[model samples]
Target chain A: MAKGTILSIDAMGGDAAPGVVVDGLAALLADRADISVLLHGNEPVLAPLVAAQKALAGRCQIIHSDTVITSDMKPSQALRRGKGSSMWNAVEAVKNGEAGAAVSAGNTGALMAISMLILRKMEGVHRPAMTALWPTLRGRTVVLDVGANLEADAAQLVTFAIMGEAYARAALGIAKPTIGILNIGSEEMKGHDEVREAHEWLRAAKLDIDYRGFVEGDDISKGAVDVVVTDGFTGNVALKAGEGVARMLGSRMREALTASLMTKIGAALAMAGLKTLRSQMDPSNVNGGVLLGLGGVSVKSHGGTDARGFARACELAADLASSHYRDEILANLARIREGGLAAE
Target chain B: MAKGTILSIDAMGGDAAPGVVVDGLAALLADRADISVLLHGNEPVLAPLVAAQKALAGRCQIIHSDTVITSDMKPSQALRRGKGSSMWNAVEAVKNGEAGAAVSAGNTGALMAISMLILRKMEGVHRPAMTALWPTLRGRTVVLDVGANLEADAAQLVTFAIMGEAYARAALGIAKPTIGILNIGSEEMKGHDEVREAHEWLRAAKLDIDYRGFVEGDDISKGAVDVVVTDGFTGNVALKAGEGVARMLGSRMREALTASLMTKIGAALAMAGLKTLRSQMDPSNVNGGVLLGLGGVSVKSHGGTDARGFARACELAADLASSHYRDEILANLARIREGGLAAE
Candidate 1:
């Protein structure tokens, strides 16, 4: 069993929160013996849900909070104003070391802002990058700055590369990940001035990363490289578009199968393969997004995640806590600083 | 018949060109008896491929050019050196009035650069935006500045919105296309300085475009809006990532189906449904990336297009030639310019 005693879960966050959060924690408690959960939300509202789940009665400790940060709140303002809110409390628990980790499905901007303000970044780390595993054709690739630092300098991009490589090693279990700079073209002379300058700096430097040259946008899922590094603005766009494509393809497949009698017949004949495809493409399995460079473990699940998806997020957080990712990242930063290579 | 006489095709461009080009032209010619093709490539190399198609024997004409512009060539060098290259010849043909439309599956930058230099922009248009239709859950959504102007200002984004809406009307058959700016958040206050300023400008302006509101990246394939406007860099990244996700999801589905014996049994049961899904996501159906705001009709296909994809590109080009897209874009540009909006 892992040594982590408690995990603070934001009950009032996400599109399908409270319910899914209760379901996930209840399911997790039945299996995980060492871990306990502190459900942060309205006490009166959540007590019934906990009482309904016999297995979760003693496993979860409810911390009643009246305020709930909705998805529409301005992240910076909400963090400053809504201190006693469920999302804020959950993150605060992790910050105070009262909880092993904190998980939220609330306003992403709010979560990011609150976390940054409460849990200051590690030494030598300028900004925290939101990293997620993008399921690719070859396998899965770790993409960083998915929606964290929108306006980043070349130094930030370099830091993103280092932190991304470390995250890949901790999360994905890849020892030596091949890193690629996401650019408009694969050629060395392509991209904007900043990208071009970064390319030269990375190529010239004796970095620990395996810089496998530049990669175009299409190469992200082709497994052409292991880690794709870019600023938050572009990374966020790519991530969202990727999600859109997955949803589009899935819906189109369903529509095509139900288009006509012949297609329906074809759909029936191909049920085996179709089921396999559906399960593979389902967002539930890959629901967690890691907030890398944070002082503690925090994951952001999908807004509309169901019970299974919520369970997956908790499961992911448990794995991350066990891996000691925070410690590793700090150690990496220390090493970079000691080597006199830390970004100024 | 569509009345357009000559169509210039880059015979030596694309992965399976010459063969694909001839096959596409032959198939198109069979349907439209009035159109003639000006095939650009090495005459000796393309002769046999042309000979293989009986309908293309003497019905099509060849503009012999030994030089070729590769997909990897720099835009400036390609434009400077590639005088008789396939893409160059195709654009030249359009400029010289030898062809009503030009289609190529070569370097996008080269095509854009050559088109800008040779045929030039339409009246009152400063820059041309490349637009492509993304297959979405709601339907097909037009995304513009797919890689045209990398560092676009507020006015350029407005131009994209105007041009994209016009393209949507001409191509997707939408009467009053709902136009939305792609931002990090959907709120009016979201995004960078450029987006914020543009939002205000678009909101205050009186134009034919149905300015819906701000949209996030995921909204592209959700069909939330008819036209998704973004700068070239963001648009390109989003477009490619979408493609990557579709390809990635398909591969993951295949892997899942072939994982084990029980899964294989499940796969066998659902084979027909799977085929239908694959057909829907197939890239062949969506081939053309139309270069909007250009003086003449020009379509850019994938650098690695097959025969069916090439044929789709030609079909899209032909369709554009028959539409009033050119005049509509010109009028729209005039409207925006008359409103006294600066480029920045």
Candidate 2:
């Protein structure tokens, strides 16, 4: 685990898997100079591809996986009959200490199911929450659970805060990440019972981290906080809704630029600045979604992303693995328990 | 109702209360030749404002109101002590058939509470849903339960679909709107119990509405379906998240355009197209949120919007009141009852 260089990869997972996976691994190795891979997928499909990647010469090894998980497979179905699958083996590698982190772009539900089954939740952690790094106006914000479980109680929300806060610290190198619950309004009594209870708990708990009061959905991208916590159901919808609107606006902008020759010339003259804006809003730039609260880091790349995006996921995994965020989470939870807000 | 020309105005609500209200009413009256206003608030504050509006000379009346509902007031509090407030008086005008509809830019929770308490729920309706008109790539999509109540059961979702469908038909003028339930994934068993049950009921029920199976969050602004249905919590989050991202991107684009002298010149040359894009994403263009399932048409404008936005809300109020959307809802409910999916 030196520098957290080794990563387990589900090479047969995403829309253009195996190819993008190998290419992404090669890209990561070239970029990081201190990374290796435990590539898991069909041997015949991946071996030649990995052999062709010059960067994979000494740093990568193919771990043959007999089964491939489809995008439509149910999590329950994955749990019962998904042993030896590429996603399963990838996560198992992390569990066995062969790799510090696992990366996949497979079926989200199935991935979460297999991930939880293989890399069980950490001690005192109620459930594993999916993580999304939202690029805000200020910088980047960490939002969870984008889709882990359907609902969360007040206690579970507290766990999300600990994990999410640690992620902001570890991944973004923030000193003391500000945390807020995602509610309909900043008002204490705006949301349901669960969010209110969690808000109260966070406010009352004597934790080392900074606990900002409630934030609304619009606060996610405005960088109102470093970490925004919410149940998976609401988080997933928010993430996707933000994504959809971004894409819509991006398309509209593109159309506007192309609508006339003058605007097209304007776009050309302003290419550098516009490109900066585009990169800032690119999904690939923020492709990795860390599955938090698990025993090992598991980064889920966007399924439709290319090698560049997957490489970003690998970078995120390496960052999370090498950082002291996990230790921070343990300490925060201990603080909560000490404050009598969480069970020992 | 004379083509729904008459609207009751809450002159003492919103961030800039009587000023914006009167100005927006004046704007709407100037735009639409047939419209009239029953302006309700402190007559002393509104009298001079109305006198200043040239459009209000022949077609406006100020009704005195003793109370003004503040944005910080809770729904329960609004219900108990809000009877003679401007919002209450405005909605009462609709209930008493003095106006075709009521328009208010006020506290959403308080507005919903007061509207329901005074206007009451329509026959066979479980709860009122706050509607948001999402500007999609294709045109627009009607999303419901933006925040009337939090959670909804399958029966309530069916009602949302019905009301959302009728809203699309009435406001957007779609003949038969396609409907979808928002979920994490598009699969049948992808989401929580409530969404799944609602999907199943929508699929099974015999209705004239086009029932698409399921839509993910990204499909909302993509116009994958004409109407999207979900619990209020999810809907509210989605709406705000979309708004947040749009605003963030907008700010970023502005920054990028002004980053360099060349880009500034390019932006100046491309100002017209960018303005079109800005108007397309403007909050004022989509300001109104219809409180459906109430006995009378009551539209809630964005609390922070300007006079232009309030005017847009008034237009939506007029549209809903004039159209046969309510009868369509009643018919759809009757159809659901006949199909044995809902209670009589």
Specify the highest-lDDT model's number.
2
Model 2 C-alpha lDDT versus the unseen true structure:
0.88
Can you write out model 1's per-residue Cα lDDT over A1-344, one digit (the tens) per residue?
23456788999998877898898888888888777888999999999999999768677889999899888888757866879999899999999988877899888878888888888787667888998788776667889888786666776777777788877776777888888888885233367776666677667666667888778788998989888988878888898888888877777767766766666664565566667667666778777888787778788888898888887888777777777656655665566566665564
Regions of candidate 2 where Cα sits further than 4 Å from its true position: A1-4, A42-54, A76-81, A186-189, A338-340, B1-4, B76-83, B186-189
Worst 10 residues of 1 chain B by lDDT: B185-194
> Which TM-score does chain B of candidate 2 obtain?
0.96
Lowest summed lDDT over 10 consecutive residues: which window, candidate 2 chain A?
A: A182-191
Could you give candidate 1's per-residue lDDT for residues B1-344 as a string of tens digits? 13456788998888777777788888878777677788899999988888788777666787899799987788888978999888899889989888888999888878888888888888767778888888877668899888876767787788788888888887788899999998885232367777777788788777877898788888888989999998878888889888877777777766765766656664555556667667656677777898888789888888777777787788778777678988887787777777887463
Candidate 1, residue A291: how far the Cα is off, in Å:
2.6
Give the winner by TM-score: 2
Predicted structure 1: lDDT: 0.80
Spell out the clash pairs found in candidate 2.
none
Error of 1 at B217 (Å): 1.6
CA lDDT of every candidate: 0.80, 0.88
